[model samples]
Every structure is written in structure tokens, then in C-alpha cells.
Target: MKDNRYSLTGYHKETNEELWLWDDLPELDMEIGYKVGALLHYEQSPFQEISMIETKAFGRMLVLDGTPQVTAKDGFIYNEMITHVAMATHPKPTKVAMIGGGDCGPAREALKYKDVQQIDVVEIDPRVIEVCRTWMTQETDYDRDGRIHTVIKDGYKWIQEQKNQYDVLLVDRSDPYGPAISLYKRPFYQYVYDSLTDDGIAVFQSGSPYYNSDILKKTIGSVKKLFPIVHTYLCSIPSFPGGIWSFTIASKKWDPLKADLNGLQWQEAKYITPEVFRASFILPGYIRSKLEEK
Candidate 1:
């Protein structure tokens, strides 16, 4: 896997772990795909890494087989959407916590809202952080910001050790499966509830609604049991299945949609306009009913 190409020849005999035939295939077939050098999946049809066909569309986005996979060249659309939504809603989220946002995109987006004075990003993998900094080199240098701090550790475990303080907490984690299993535990959600101020809110990336409906629904149900108000939003990502992805908002006191956008600050963004905000809330009938509120 010298240049990010691998094939699943078979699983380990006793471990049952996936065994891949790693070879340097950076150009032809492009057998593997990585977000920011972090392997997402091999043979994942929805996304493919195409070498030499980089996108000049955004800035220098890597268009994997014609699909926008990770950091868009022009902007951080998904990151802005996720962070700004919560920041706009909460009256003044002064102190914030972000779990697993190694890309630094979410931190960049959050810092724009001037009210957020301090942000603590708790990430598990030092390698992911190193890769993103070395590869993407997003403008928000993790090394310089006074408002932004890093606590390299297990997010769930760290959350359990906190007090009732944060105004908003964003879980910018990977999917709720595999290495991120602890993120979906009921106890972890409870800790998130406990770590927030009375009016604090938490936003998280749930998963693709089409493929993981059960997991998505269960997470909402569990969060609803913890926070009095919970709402889910959808965003479109070409790499993810169903074109639309699920995000859940949990708060002890706040409505994400009723948030006042004017109160928040944003430098500039390619997506996530006021109109986009309104449209994002209008979910399908089935999804609305599933949440038990319209």
C-alpha cells in the first residue's frame, strides 16, 4: 500500500480481520480511497480515487472518480453547516467542545462565530491530525489559536470527566460503528447531557439515513430520553449513500431551527445560506413523523 491501492484477498484465518493485498497503485484502477490519507473504504462504489483528475473547481479539491469526497477546494461546506447551525441557535455559546474533528475544518467554522471564545477539540488519533495538517494544511493552524485548544485522548472518556459547563458540544466523529462504537453508547450520551450547561446543545453526525435507519432512529430515541428536545437534519454528500446524510441535535433547552442566524458571525461560506437553513429543516414526511414532531 505504498500509494494507497489495496485489494481484499481474504480475512485473517483466526482473527477474521480483513486482509488486503496492498500495492502501490496510485494511478491505474485507484484501488483504494482515503479522505485525508485516512483509508475510508476499498471498493466502495459510491466513491473512487482517481489520480491526475484533481478538481480546480473549488481550490484544489480531490475529486475521487468525479465525486466530492473530502475537503472541498472552494470551501468547507459540511463543516460550516454542522458548526454554524449550533452556534447560530445557542444564544451565546462561549465555551465549546468538539470531539474527533481532526480535519480542523469544524474548528475553523466555529471560530468565525465571535461569541465562541474557547474551543476544545478532543481527538483520539494523533495520526489523523498529523496527516490532515501535513496534507490539507487548512488555514486554521492548530498550533497558533489561543481560543482553540487540543486534548489528545479518548473523547468519551474525557467527557465523563467533565463538569456542567460547555455551552455547545459538537461530535464531529466518523460513523457510529467500528472504531467509533463508544460514541453511540447510551452512557456516553448521558455524559454529554451532564457536561452541558442548562441551555447547552449538542450536534452530531449520525450517519446515512438510507443505510443506517435503525441506528439513526435509535440514537435519536436515546438522545431524546436524555435531552428534552432533539431534532435531526439532512445534508447531501456525494460520497455517502442516499445522497442525504443524517445529523441529530440534542439540547437541554433550545430549538435548532428557531435559531437566530443574525446573532452569529461567519467570515464567508460557499454553502449554508439562510435559504439553505430553511430548506434543510423541511424533512420528508416519514422522517418528521419518526421524530414525533413537525
Candidate 2:
């Protein structure tokens, strides 16, 4: 028989336990790892270091700047939550703008809605798209869609050029580290505010409150300054550092919590349901208290 036991090549393997340690939380001083099968693609993009690895458990995974951006097994949790909640709230979100979703996950998820007529994906690094297309084909395929437009440019600068344009803007940006740092700032949220229609809605993946509480608080504060309705919700994904992840919705008009889901049908969704959608907004007291602080 060919040696088909899960391969652990190129990963930091221990003598007794073979694992790939994701050392993202240094201050917390803990690491998470997955047994790996193969090293598919690794590259240094102008923006960040991109790597695609085939894991023993989570299927194909995309890691940017040493953080797991998406995995085949549970990507729908992140993408669907980010896209559907806001998309469902708006009565007619024809024009959608997705900033920094280079892997095509968010674009693919957003494309599922029949109401979304046009989707513009502004990805800063073309390398992330190329790698994802070549290696992570199973999770994403928005490049083939005629309605989707892929722009290789800085998302912050790109959003500034538009005014009252997009009905739904989904910021599927990387962690607030390198080129993505600007996307989490107050000015960018103002740009996002300007880029939306009067009834437009926006949602971005706020980092984990378990590990990145500061990010969640800062994001809520910045967005609250511009939008009358600013809400934060939680979604859990195993591949990310903390099992619990956060996304914030900012809207000029519609309140996502009271979204009328009278006719929305999410046929392809593995995670999000109408009931789950409403429950996601109901945060725990601790997290709510954090957001409530000045």
C-alpha cells in the first residue's frame, strides 16, 4: 500500500505530536495547530505573505501574514454571516461592493443573492486571488461570474473614489496588521459611510473579541460616529484564532436585528438560517458591556 497516512511535511512537527503551530497570540502565549497533509503554495505578495496548505482536518486553508483567512471546512460560516445578514436587511441591494475579499469567498457568498445585481471586489493583492484560484478552487469561484468585477487596488483608496454608490458593502479584509490596518481606522469607516446609499448597509469582519477585544471596541466606536444604527454580531469559526469571531453592521437606515426575512431563501447556506440570523445579534452581557463603553 502507498504511504497515505496524513503527511506532515513543512510544518513544525513535534517528536511525539505532529502539528502546525499557529503562533498568532504571543501575549496570550498559546498556539493552535492542525495536522497537515501537503504544502501547496507559498508566496510573498507585495502586501503580505500568502500560504495555502492542505490540512488533515480543515481541508484546504489560506493563511495571510501568518493568520488563517479562510478554510474550506467552515468558510461558509464567515462568508455567509458577513454577506447575508446585511444583504437580507436591505430591501434591494442591487449594487454591492466587497473590499479585500481576494479569496472570492465573500464575493461568491454575496453572488448567491438574486437581488444583488453587481458585485465589485476590490482586492489589494492580485497574488492572493491567483493563489486562491489555483489552490482553493473548491471554496470559491467568483472570477467566472459575469456580474462580478475584480479590481486589484488598495481598498481604502478605492472606497474613497465612490460616493453613495453601493447598496451593500462587505469588508472582507485581512486582520488589522499590514496593508489592512487602514481598513479598520476611523477615516476608512467614514469612507465606507460615504460610499453607501442613504439606505445602504455595510458589514466587516471585526476580529475575535476573545483575543481582539480592542479591535471590536475601536471598530464599534468609529462606526457609531457616522451611522445611526451600528450593531455587532458574533459567528464562530474553528480555523480562526478564537472559535468566536465578530462582525459589525453599520447602516444609515435599516436595522439588521429587525430585518424582514419574509421571502429570503438561502438555499446554499450550511450555517446561516433565519432564526440563527436573529440570534447572532443577541450578544452576551460581557461583550455588550464592552461595546456600550465610551
Candidate 3:
């Protein structure tokens, strides 16, 4: 994608959207031709358009039909906070599993912790793995960590097959649709519960606070049914459909806000700061009422 980084060249036809393609595009390793125009991205079944688009800028970006979907850049803030906070608080986090992060962003972010020795990245699409390498960049340290071992398989299958438990389970998935539809199921949450060490924490990307409130609440409720502790947090990432997004953190033993970072200091990031980190946990009045939480 990067090698063939094509800007919106020219939109064609007068259908629902303005269809366009990259001129200097990479080999369409997985497409007959993409139907992308204006804001809509779809392809015929034999040439099915995308339900997703993974980019470093927007994080795990998705554009389905004619609407813009979630972006990973803003989503990463909550993800990193949820994941690293839990791991840092642990006495030691030697092993971790990230399900459905085909973009490999979370795996790249998790490697920042020196204590993390093994990170298993399970993505459902191998094609995604291929595209991301060209799209995400070879220069970023997030993608260049040594601890990551990529597994091209269904995350559920991979999680089920493993007997060895993990210190943390990060469900870095797209919104609960397409291949990700299975990820939101309660049975999957129970499997996640079984797959974790006694001290394990499971964190997932819930949808936006401003949009899809019902979906976020239902998903949170499901995780709450599966774990003793469940909490939702928020962040603002501009590229997503909604301006601010949410995440749910579920745990059996550790709570994120209370977790110590174990002196694993990181440099400043554009989104997640100490102040923003603390502030993100403080849900607004509207969102709190949405959860029916005081």
C-alpha cells in the first residue's frame, strides 16, 4: 500500500460514492479491482470491496459500504493504556496474546515493555499481514520488535489450541463484524477467561461513546458476565467515524487504574499522556448514564 501510496486520483461514476483507485498502486495481490470512491469502499463478491482498511495513521481503519468506520490511531491510546497498565502492574509479564490485530499495531506497541519476552499475534487474515507490511512501514519501532511471533490463523482457534496461559490477553479486533463477529460472542469471552493465567486481564476495543452506544453497552455487559471486573474508557481519535472512541477492560485479578507501570517508562506519544491517561478513565456524564453506572 505504501509503495503504491495513491492519493484520491479521480472519482468516477455517479453512483452512491465517487469511485477512484491509486494510480501508482502496489500489486493488487488480493483484488480484481477495488470499488473505492468518495467515502464508500466495496467490491463485488468475486471482487468484493473491503470491510476494513488498516493504516498506521488511523490505526485499524475500516470503511464499509459508504461510511467511514473506526480508526486505530485513536483506538491505540485506550488499547495501550488498557494493555500496558495491566502488564506493568503484574509482577512480571513474560507472555502475552493479542487476538485479531492483523495490523500488528498492538504487538508493536506491547514490545515496548522490557519484561515482555513472548508475544503471540493471531490475525484471521494472512492477506492483511501482507498488506500491512507494505502499509504500516518498516521504519517504525512498533513493527520491528523481536518479541512478536505472528500466527496467521483464527484468533479463536489459536486461543483454544493453546494450553499454556498468558499474562495478558489483548483483543485488538475490528468492530464486531465480518470475521470479528465471533469475537464478541460470550463463549469467546469464556474461552478468553480460560486462556488466561490466574492474574490475567482481557481488554478489547469497544466502539465509540458518541456512536453505537448500545453495541458498546451490550459488549461490556457480556464481558462483565464473563469476568468479575469490567470497565469502559474513552479517547479522541479524529480519523474514526466518531470523534471519540471507547474500550472495555475486563480482569480476574488486576485493575488498570491501580496498576503500577513497573518503572517501564515510555517517551511521549501524541495521544496517550499521563494527564490524558488519567482523564480517559473519567467517563463523561452522558457515557456513564449509557452504561447505567454511577
Q: What lDDT score belongs to each candidate, Candidate 1 first? A: 0.68, 0.81, 0.64
Best by lDDT: 2
Candidate 1 wrongly placed segments (more than 4 Å):
1-69, 73-75, 140-142, 289-294
- lDDT tens string, model 3, 150-215? 887788777777653988888876666566788888788888888888878878878878767877
Candidate 2, residues 1-294, lDDT tens digits: the string is: 112322322246556555463544667877666655776877777777788888866898887766677888888888888888888898888999899878777788777778878999899899988898888754435556788888988999999999999999999877787778899887899899999998999998888887878898988888989999998999889877768989999999998877888645577788888988888888989887777776
**Comparing 2 and 3 by lDDT, which wins?**
2
Q: What is the lDDT of residue 6 in candidate 1?
A: 29
Q: What's the residue-level lDDT of 216 in candidate 3?
A: 85
| True lDDT of residue 80, candidate 2 | 87
CA lDDT for candidate 1: 0.68
Angstrom error of the Cα, residue 11, model 3: value is 8.0
Q: Better model by lDDT, 1 or 2?
A: 2
Estimate the TM-score of every prediction: 0.76, 0.91, 0.75
| lDDT for predicted candidate 3 compared with the true structure | 0.64
Q: How many clashes in candidate 1?
A: 3
